[model samples]
Target: MAEQNRTSVAELVLEGLSERAEVKAALFVLLLLIYTLTLLGNMGIIVVIWGDPQLHTSMYFFLGSLSMVDICFSSVTAPRTLVNFLLERKTISFTGCMGQAFFYTVFVTTGCFLLAVMAYDWYVAICNPLLYSSVMTHRLCIWLVVGSYIGGVLNSIIQVTFIIRLPFRSSNVINHFFCDVPLLLALSCASTYINSMILFSMAGVIELSTISTILISYIFICFAMLRIRSSEGRQKAFSTCVSHLTAVTMLRRTTIFIYLRPSSSYSPNTDKVVSIFYTLVIPMLNPLIYSLRNQEVKSALRRTAERITVRL
Candidate 1:
């Protein structure tokens, strides 16, 4: 009976952003444009950092890692979504949905932790300038990046395990654009009390702690900047952190809203809009956020362009 209940729904119908033919076409075109730009923007950052020897620092290294994450994390869902928008019958196999859920969880978790690590790096650079070189060694940065990935995968595995075990019944229509924890939990016929407890309690704690660390680091950074006597010196000090500050604010706002809440409170309509922001809009905007206001990145891009022209 238990096994029968689980196999009842093998493929899920994705009720995406719209149902009208005209709306689907518009959405497809718009998303395609955004997705193309997202790829170019993020890959452009990675390539620029790689080609420019001047950017071979702990800060740029982390930035490059972040670009990679944005690219990959966006890729996991965007392509499938684009495909579904065009298809008459929007369906994903159970296995594919599970895989999507897992990867989505992993990349999102990794991105959050990476932001926290970057915050710590900024704190070290600003607050402890003299010790920055000694503390944020190349070895340590690599470990931090690697550890974030490992931690994300581990967390995804645990969460996906809990979710996959729950028996989904006759209701196979996922109201959102993609398969996510909240939507999946809503679909499950089995008792999701334990799942809700873990998601709200465990996930909430992690998000809260990460945000607290970021806040504390920025507090110390503000104090450090205030200590600078010269206006020029203070501005210079603050410039180094502005891009990161913006990125953190954008990522944390949508993430905290989506994850740190009770399952019962999750309205599919509101959650889907938030999902589009973090998964699609944020990834598209991240590279622009980092590069547009950044002089170093602008200079590196110019140098990279000159080198490419020379090669041509």
Candidate 2:
């Protein structure tokens, strides 16, 4: 009976970001612009990092991996969102919804781990400059990235497996633009205590572990910077870390707000607004944040542009 009920709901309707016609139209245009910029900005970073020998370091490798993840992460929902804005009935099939949730979890979790890895990279670079080259080798960088994806895939499989087994009997209307675990949990017919516990525990573990890594890395970095007697040296070390700190704060706060709590406390409207920032806006902002603050990236971009102009 539970299995039958679970399979009964073939499709689910999404409430999306807005209901009013004018709002939808405006958001459609706005999201389109943001999505375009996200692709261009992230892709531009990847290309610049790849083409420039100056950026052939562990730091830039991680940055390139992050750009690729942002592209995948945003793509999980952005196109469907744009399409839904045109359609009267915003619906997703059960398979599609689960798939979206699964991939979204995978990419987002991977991104969190990657950020932690990058934080560790910064720690090594700033705290142990002499050993940075030896510590963060190309092989080690590749393994770290692969491990992040592995962790993401494992978490996603567990979470989505439990979610897919849930019997969503009646309510097929999800209260957000995309399929999220909390919203989906609310739609299930059976008691979601186990599911909620699993969600909170899994999310908590990821958040706690990653954030702890970042915090500890920064703490060591701070100590290392303090030992440097020169103000200029301290400032240079701080500059390297500030951009990553900004991104971590932005992403961690929203994710903790959404996932590390009970589903009963979820505010649909608030979640939707926050989701927009992380999902659509953050990807667009990451490259800008990194590139604008980074002189090396700026130099690379300038050189790349000059080369392109010469070719043209």
Query: What's the lDDT for all of these models?
Result: 0.87, 0.93
Model 2 residue runs over 4 Å out of place are none
The TM-score, computed over Cα atoms with residue i paired to residue i, of candidate 1 is 0.96
- Candidate 2 collision pairs: none
Over the stretch 243-262, how does candidate 1's per-residue lDDT look in tens digits?
A: 88888899888887887765
RMSD of each: 1.5, 1.2
- Top candidate on TM-score is 2
Error of 2 at 227 (Å): 2.3
Candidate 1 Cα errors over 4 Å, as ranges: 1-7
For residue 267, model 1's alpha carbon misses the true position, in angstroms, by 2.7
lDDT of 2 by residue, 1-312 (tens): 767756589899998999899999999999999999999999999999999999999999999999999999999999999999999999999999999999999999999999999999999998899999999999999999999999999999999899888888788999899997778888988888998899889999999899999999999998998899989878767777888998899999889888876656778899889999999899999998898878899999999999999999
Error of 1 at 244 (Å): 1.4
